[model samples]
Target: MPAKRKLKLVITLIGLLVLGGGWLIVSAQNHPSSQPAQQTQAKSKPKYRTLTLDELHHDPTLTYCSIIYYTVKHGKIQRWQEVSKVSLGWQIEQYPTNDGFKVLVWPDMNIKKEAKQLQPNWFALTKNDSVTYHSFIIHSFRDDMTATTNLKTIVDQINHDHAAMKVRQMTPKMLIVKHKNSAN
Candidate 1:
């Protein structure tokens, strides 16, 4: 009976040792300093920097920019999709409304047909308000509003008017747009 008890204790200790060792190895691998240089570089390769709206406009090299919307859930990106693509040359018209400015980005003729936002992609940015509100037309009552209502539908699911949106230039061609309100 004593021999059996000794054997059982040994087995339990061995199992615990194995588990502890495995945990250590995993933790070491996950540690930043222990990670390979190549892996670290890969993680930070496409370095994204915040660019002002004025900078985005002044950059003549920028042909066009795509509005990519992403939602983070459980500390992971759950939904990601390209919502709208507007040419850099597209005229940004601002109409003075009673409350704020109705900002409309008119599509350029040279814009690719595939990247066009067929429906009105107008957004409102409030002025002289205590809490600045940003709103955009993200839906249409009629199906005939646009050939592809998918973009609007997707945008509607993710964002609301209360959240503010900002533009960030990635590369000479790529643009990363960040909106405060997202479907988390």
Candidate 2:
């Protein structure tokens, strides 16, 4: 073979090798299988963390007072309990008063009247005038069990903390009747 032709062939082979190597690097960078495991796992994690009662209260979106009921036991409430620093996503707001916690649950697309009925029960065990009832339909239960359980836990904590707390129980049936009658 001629020396000039041999040189041309060698140069072409070198150029092809360089182009193939560049293509492989670019393809590996774009493929997820070639990425580090940590990066892929991080992306799969949730963006929003579960908020606790304290965190939920400070949230800017919770504004409406959806429920307004007070427990009418024989004794007066001493003081309300403070929330912890833990993070959770129990989308509800609570305003503690001398009578009881005025719970304001967050808005939801699947809100039901039955869930609203569950609110007053958290304050009082039975049906009676002690558990007052006044709520609108703006906000409903995000997680009914979570909302009720948290409310009960907070109220219980507050009552437990106060030495002179007078907790009461009312009849659920009577309270429902009163609530319906008053709605007129």
Candidate 3:
């Protein structure tokens, strides 16, 4: 009888220990205590803008733009995409104010010949290139309110400042659209 009682006590103790071990393992798996994560940990993040590639095409004033904003990334731009629509020289973007374009032309004097000769050259560049009527990528909070305004404004401002066209020759008040590169 005493041996049987002793055996039962030992088994109960072992079972309890096994159960406790199992619970600890499960708890550890569910929530690791060693590696803690804070809700307010600081992280470096990149700023992004909503932009459309189309803005460059429609604007009447801009003869050309270089380095327009492509698709935005969640974090800091690690690398530039191959600038699918246009070359690296120019790109389109929307400013919050959309007040106007801030053109940083090299030798600011180029603005004169740039407007006259640049268009024809750029147009020739797109001679047989664009697959679409205009390859535009629009990004906006609402589909209606687009950042397209900025590109046009910037180009217009440049035009107003330079009063030049990429196309060399033109008729009176003729609306000219310069294709920066050949449109396939």
Question: What TM-score, computed on C-alpha atoms, does each candidate reach?
Answer: 0.26, 0.34, 0.25
Rank by TM-score, highest first: 2, 1, 3
Model 3 reaches what TM-score against the true structure?
0.25
Error of 1 at 176 (Å): 19
The digit string of per-residue lDDT tens for model 1 on 1-184 reads 6999999999999999999999999999879999889888978884434333344245422212212221211112111111233234343434566664444444442345475545434344334321121223245353222111222332333334211132223223332233333211
- Cα lDDT of model 2 by residue, 1-184, tens digit: 9999999999999999999999999999999999999889889983433223353244222111111112222213211111111121123434545443443432332345665543322232111113333332225544322122233343444344441111111111111111212111
The count of backbone overlaps in candidate 1 is: 0
Runs of candidate 3 exceeding 4 Å displacement: 32-66, 69-184
All candidates in order of lDDT, best leading: 1, 2, 3
Please give the lDDT score at residue 38 for candidate 3: 50
Q: lDDT of all predictions, in order shown?
A: 0.38, 0.35, 0.31
Model 2 stretches with alpha carbons more than 4 Å out: 1-10, 52-54, 60-100, 104-119, 122-184
Q: Among these predicted structures, which one has the highest TM-score?
A: 2
Report the lDDT tens digits of candidate 3 across residue range 71-160.
111112222232222212332222111233222212122134444322111111121212111121234233221122223443334344
**Candidate 3 weakest lDDT stretch, 10 residues:** 124-133
